[model samples]
Target chain A: MQLKTQTRPKVISVLVMEDRIDAATAIQFKERMRDVTKDAPARVVLDLARVQFLDSSGLGAIVAVKKLLGPDRALELSSLTPTVEKVFRLTRMDTVFTIHPSLEVAVASAASV
Target chain B: MPPQPVSDHDPRRSSLTLVFQADPVSIRQALQGMLTCPPLSCLRGEDRGMAELVLAEVLNNVAEHAYAEAGGKVEIRLDGDPRGLRCLVVDEGREMPGGQLPEGRLPCGPYVALDDLPEGGFGWHLIRSLCADLAYARVDGQNRLAFVLATGS
Candidate 1:
């Protein structure tokens, strides 16, 4: 559950460094997100470019992170791989969060807003 | 000469059997192995992804629910073909409650509260959505779950 965080102005982007987030690491992922975003800005963009696999447990963990951030802060996702996108699509979770096609786009949108 | 028969030994028809402890770490390792092996390795794009996701959900259920506190062994037998893969998972642990599978309804909706948002229950939904001919049975102190993952090939 290695996550790299970068803060820029109003938004912070956290890059998931690992290739897979499954049952084995969902809890850790959530906890790490909490720790990194504890005092961050109102918008958080999670870059999933490196993640190759995510199970339901992993998906749930991401949702948990969103809830943890509450209504004040937004948790946006970017660069979802083919399978990751499928999970979000099948679960209809893709509708819940703002999903950007790339990290640059996610951050750029944050800059504009 | 007559057309050749498609025997069980045909290279196109293959199966892989894996037996491991019912634990998250072990299940991860098993999934990695399966993806690298024949038939599963032969899958591509969304087909391969679906296989990994479905198997992960099923195996995780065994580790988290079936075994729970009482650790046990789990066996996975996968038969692969041009169309898709047939997966059978067996565990020598607790039977599914009421000896039946869950209905696997989606837990989220457009109006659910943020606090009430589900952190779980998505596993079965994913399994049901991606798998076909899904079946579960408790027999002779073992839980057997079978499903077919279509590769669209």
Candidate 2:
């Protein structure tokens, strides 16, 4: 699995290419993001188009990253699969963060800000 | 103690129990059974959604991550009480991940700030939000995960 990070202006967009996110990789994921964006004000866009499944641990890691961001920055989500999307909707997380249909829109919105 | 009132009954006594392999399909079936209490057929939309999402995540963790691809047996026991549903997942796998919060301070929900955009931490948040209690332990190379949710008051 590859987590590619790109910085455009103030935006940091990440593409996740793993079929599933669960306990096995949740911590690794948290560490990578924490290490990559250390103290940076990044409008992160997580592209989950390739993620076929997402378990609770994976969701926790995402929340952890959101916590790390604090009160100033923006954490955007994009390309959530239907099953994955169902999870967010079921948990009412769709109301918590900014979700986008595509990475381009996420980046464009970040750029506009 | 003297004979207790029916209203004071412990829901644990009414709980249903079952065991299954640590597979996604089996887990799904078990959850279906847990959510639907006989005469009720299947659970309603809300309860079914919660049960499916929570079980899918927990069981997937057991089958794929906890074992780390090494084949092993996982035992699941479920109890449905008037208080709510409780589940225990027992597995002889690698050491369990030390992911537990102190007492009642379980952290649940996504972070709003952009700077805190955690590149990955979101799974536990989902679990915490869906269930009333979640506990974990590693004993003699066995991982035991217990979760509980409350029903009507």
Candidate 3:
């Protein structure tokens, strides 16, 4: 999966350019995310506005990515589609990560810091 | 995983039973069929997400655990209407890890420590939480799991 990254002073935003994150793509997604996030800022937001479907594997992969980023860096999630958002809530992962309604909102919050 | 032809119709409650090879590609086809099924076509928003998520978890589990990297058959039966949905999944493979379904529990979450947070083991929890009723049974060398989600009625 191809990912787009935008760097700023406060946070680096990675846009996931896929519609579905399932068992079929979860591994690749995580691997690609690692490459994109290697040199990112401490605060990173995964913009998932385009993704409309997510399964448990996808959720686990995201959590793995967060752990890989280490303790100091925070991996935030933004622009979660309703379907993707439900997975986070049902699994209670919503509490684990800082979630935002949109990429702009997450970026704005980080910029203000 | 093997391919088996499915009849377009099943007489029981207008149910549809589709047998798929226990793999990611076949799982995706089954999911696509559910998303477009006439009875479930109206599913949108939270309901749609729940169905897709639960289905994926169950099917993937069969592919990952039951089959254990071997070829197998996964059967998915759907009986749903405007009010609710009942999903039955059957797999011809090894029994559950301990010959039982994973007891669903809320994961320790919203934690400050990364080590404390869990990455996997959330699938069964979500399945139990979203489905109004869930049951699992092994019959005649087949693993059967039934899930009911009440959309309105």
Clashing pairs in 1: none
Candidate 3 chain A: minimum summed lDDT over ten consecutive residues — where? Answer: A83-92
Q: Of the candidates numbered 2 and 3, which has the greater lDDT value?
A: 3
Model 3: chain A TM-score against the true structure:
0.97
Residue range with the least summed lDDT across 10 consecutive positions in model 2 chain B: B99-108
Ranking of models by TM-score? 1, 3, 2
Which has the better DockQ: candidate 1, or candidate 2? 1
- Once fitted onto the true fold, the runs of candidate 1 whose alpha carbons sit more than 4 angstroms away are B1-11
Candidate 1 lDDT over residue span A20-65, tens digit each: 9898999999999999999989999999999999999999999999
Question: In candidate 2, what are the lDDT values of residues B1-153, reduced to their tens digit?
Answer: 998764534444454556676665566566557656521122444554555566666676677677775556777666655456777778886665444432322233455444433343344555666787688887787888898854442
- Which stretches of candidate 2 lie above 4 Å from their native place? B1-55, B60-72, B75-153
Residue A4 of model 1: what lDDT? 96
lDDT of 1 by residue, B79-140 (tens): 98767788999999898999899999999787777888888899889999998999999889
Which digits, one per residue and each the tens of the lDDT, describe model 2 over residues A30-111?
8887876775555788888888666666676777777777667667899987767877775556777789999988888888
TM-score each candidate.
0.95, 0.52, 0.90
True contacts kept of each: 0.85, 0.35, 0.85
State residue B148's C-alpha deviation in candidate 1, in Å. Answer: 0.8
Clashing pairs in 3: B1-B71
